[model samples]
Target: MKLTQIATATALFFTAQLAFADNPETQTQPAPAVEFLLPSVEVVASPPSTPLFSITDPKAPRQPLPASDGADYLKTVPGFAAIRSGGTNGDPVLRGMSGSRLSLVANGAPIEGACPARMDAPSSYIAPESYDKVVVVKGPETVLYGPGASAGTVLFERNTPRFTEAGVRASGSLVGGQFGRNDQNVDIAAGTPDVYARVTANKAHEGDYRDGNGNTVPSAWNKWNTDVALGVTPDADTKLELTAGTGDGNARYAGRGMDGVRFRRDSVGLHFEKQNIGKVLRDIDARVFYNEADHRMDNYTLRETPPGSMPMAADVRRRTVGGRIAATFDLSERVEWVAGADWQVNWLASRSVMGIQNLSDMPWTPSATLSNYGVFSELTWFASDVQQVIAGLRFDRAAATDDRQSISGMMSSMPNPTFDEQRTRVLPSGFVRYEQNLRALPLTWYAGIGHTERFPDYWELFSPNSGPAGSVNAFAGIQPEKTTQLDIGAHYRGGAVDAWVSAYAGYVNDFILFTYNTSMGKATSQATNVNAEIFGGEFGATWKPDGHWRVGVSSAYAWGRNADSGAPLPQIPPLVTRFTVDYTLGAWSAGALWRVVSSQHRYALNQGNVVGYDFGPSGGFGVVSLHAQYDINKRTQLTVGVDNLLNKAYSEHLNLAGNAGFGFPANTPVMEPGRTAWARLSFRM
Candidate 1:
């Protein structure tokens, strides 16, 4: 088919689907009771409100992992995917959306890494095991955080301490598992009724991981971190906090060409929250923070470079700093409001020696750097006890300024030059929603529409050597992406028969894309501002008609398409369903999870049926799990779980490229592990 015809067809398909979101009938079905089972070690057994697709909540006591970097702990959350380069630092993705789309916050502050290729993704600097909780809010449902979360927002927070009377409290855990996974974590707090001090530390390491085929993948890593904070609570309504932290780690990769030989990070922050100022204003939660990262790559970190593979390779580095402030107000008993602003700036530098057989010295590429800043706010109004309306708006301006006398790796015609070019962008976003609670039917219904704008991130700009004929490097060349979407859903609970369902559809403009050319042996990608459509829903049910037995089943499906390209976007997973059943008898609960994923058939990059490396159309795989928990007294518990019990060999649609260095046989491919088991012991005093 002609390109125009293909484009026309794609546009028409999306137009019809996106328009369906407003029908309201889409959410008429009853909602099933769907409770998420968080990670065994740090899990919050149950809560008054069920937080879907979330693995952690702030109510639980903080328990740092015995040993780990941030990426290792993210795996505990379902629907989260990561690109593996090494053990300590993995690129994090949620619902297939990656890069700058997802916002990462630590202790309610923002910090980004300095690597051009994302050698130090923000999450990599975090010690997940060291924090108290990890909260993930999916989709663009709320706007209270910073900006550009078209995918979602992830908040890794440290729990706050409150004491009515003078007392000291502490919680700790120890874990020893397969693959040399030994972790020890401790959280301690002590002070007078009005003051408290807290501290956390962690470390971890692993050898190369063997895939299902027993072929080792370059995943070896080593890392450690420490955090100290002081809190003063004059009263329950007001509090002040000051925090400082430092962490560093290194990883070896089999998939990427380079390894992270050095991962050094430093950060400091201050936050204050005041509540109940008057009848009209509720409180102000504000903060200021600074974070920096330095990364190094060399041949000695992973393995000796092969011939013709840029040998004698060594040394590269990057750095970044960010800050923000936010406030909340209670206009009245039924209405609340919020506003905030944030900014980020980063710099890059690299030096390497390359030659034949590690013999000669090649001059290093000149150091390069860029800077960006944005200003962004959000508000909500409650209509009645059973109804609410929420609206939010934000405007952001980002600019990239570079200072250099000469440009490296440019065309010959572009002779010597010394000047500065700066590009500034303006973006505005807004959303509105209405919710209703029908007490007569014991059900709650909500519907909303939102639009968001995302600025181009460093990876999209600095990583690419060239942009389209008329554009600059991705940073200056790509336009800001905007998304207008509608979300509608309902929750219902009817004794013995509970169910739930939520659906959403979106229209996207200026959707970024990446294309790879195997024949040319190079990756060709760009940001194409095109219309797009996305829709999905999750449903589940639970039946416990009588005591001692229970049956439950749940399913989720999401789909996305680029209307202008007539091609399926990368990393969109196929339909998936999960079934669980369990029994409870005399102090013990046992359950099983049976999951099935349909085969993915739509693809574009590699061909009509593409299926490999940063591409799509992956075959399907099934997995099963068995779990049990024992309540050993009110303060202590023991839980054991076995994953992939059948030892099935499988992989997710989104996967990391395996490095050739770490022992992955050239002709053979690597797959995730077949099976794994874990046990958790918890103590609180």
Candidate 2:
């Protein structure tokens, strides 16, 4: 569908909803009072709400001046790290795993990026502040959202608006910080019992940030998004909604040869939900969505062209359409079953121009087309008041077709052996878990085992220049990745203490690995398969000794090795920990956060994923930050904070090397931002 058509339809729907609210029979109600205040800043995310699952409010103010994108916000959660490229749009890594292993879903749809180098990752398109809820399911423990979530699954969702009478509700925020940073957000909803309309929009911008050494990092970005939703509530048990949104952004990357001049996103979706259908069928939910990502990068748009290098630009786009249907059944008094089927189809195309030609004017070339169909069922049995069993099974058929007439080689275009060829795989995934709640103590323990088979993603199949030995290319050589893992965890909640710990160990067969090599002054990457072993864990605790005081601590660690080569895995994050203390009194509160990260000594040189590589050993560092909040009124609040208080210059272990075009030495990791201050004003009515 066209963007204009979607926008026009949304406008009409919103007007209709408002007109319905003007009915003489409709009873107008006063807005409710705000009863609770959100935390000033989230230094460390609260412990998981359940076994391997966490739910967070995405609109809450957070440390480090909030986030510019989804990945930046996930870093506050333990076991989550980001591969930073610049001021924004960092790629998210969970348990040292990247790529398709982590399923990212936004509003019941999967959005894929078109950049072969992954400059615009899936998370880049997600505006976290625009969503009402963020749910994280760690590990391959569930089969509800999608397939191949061996590392984890993250969902960004917007709750359907419901109203008892004719009324309006709104919330918003404004932010300002050093380095020319600023942000604005607004959310508004209006409705009666029969219909509702909601709108959310945000804009964020920043200039180049300085490091501890007082050097500019060549990082800057600007982004904006607007979304609209109209819902019809025929009864208390049913809801039907339609959503539309569009967003665009630009960024200057310090770690790549080109800067992103455009990141255009357009989306449309329809959702249906029903509950309490019958004695056996509890509820049914279904949705269909369309998402498109049109991206462009150039060497001259955001910065000056390198000396003696001609200006160059490339444009690429991916169009995805998907639908899913799921139903929940009360099989017995104690057993509940959920079954679903989903299917998706995506097409990618690109065009490029050199010198003085406009890239957009060039005719597009078809690159690849991919599709998947999956069916899944999950069962939960409540054996007793204190015991439960959960199991799930899923099967997927995935296929990819290469549409390229020829592949690019080191020196020139070459005949492609896999041109116009199709490859397919049938994969299966399943998991089982047992849970026990101690009757005498406020604690719960659980254990589970899961196995998954993942088809090679676009980056692994087409981005590499070469493939395994004796293979034509990555598309023809890379094999499916299979992982089997055991997970165990415990959660304890009592008087003043709340704590949780989770751990996982897994063996991966045919794990995909990338190796970077420089020959004849040209850098090329090869995709290969290897056996790998991985293990990791995260622990956290919070102590509320009294109503006025709160303290928290959390840490995460991950390790991996190539079983075939006996070498450490590339791009694994080092151990990291956080300590937080807060004091609240009346309408004012203050807090402090200290973060420590260990040095990384084990790594495979020049090897990693499509986005980053292991350059060398990295040094450890620590930093501190402080924040305060004041309630301006019942409906307004103000928050202020300073990050990197000590001006510590450090780089994360999972990092991309600084681009030489930005005046940084080859193989040098990009440095993080220095000491900075920021403030945010939020209000609701």
Among these predictions, the greatest TM-score belongs to: 2
For model 2, the stretches where C-alpha displacement exceeds 4 angstroms are 1-30, 519-521
Overall lDDT per candidate, in order of appearance: 0.62, 0.90
lDDT per residue (tens digit) for residues 208-276 in model 2: 999988989989999999999999998888999999999999999999999999999999999999999
RMSD of 2: 5.6
Q: For candidate 1, what is the TM-score?
A: 0.83
Give Cα distance to truth, residue 40, candidate 2, Å: 3.8
TM-score of every candidate relative to the true structure: 0.83, 0.95
In candidate 2, which residue pairs get closer than 3 Å at backbone N, Cα or C atoms, i.e. clash?
none
Q: Candidate 2 — what's its lDDT?
A: 0.90
Clashes of each: 15, 0
lDDT (10s digit) by residue, model 1, range 171-249: 5444444455444455677767699898877666666655555655566777778888899999887788888888777
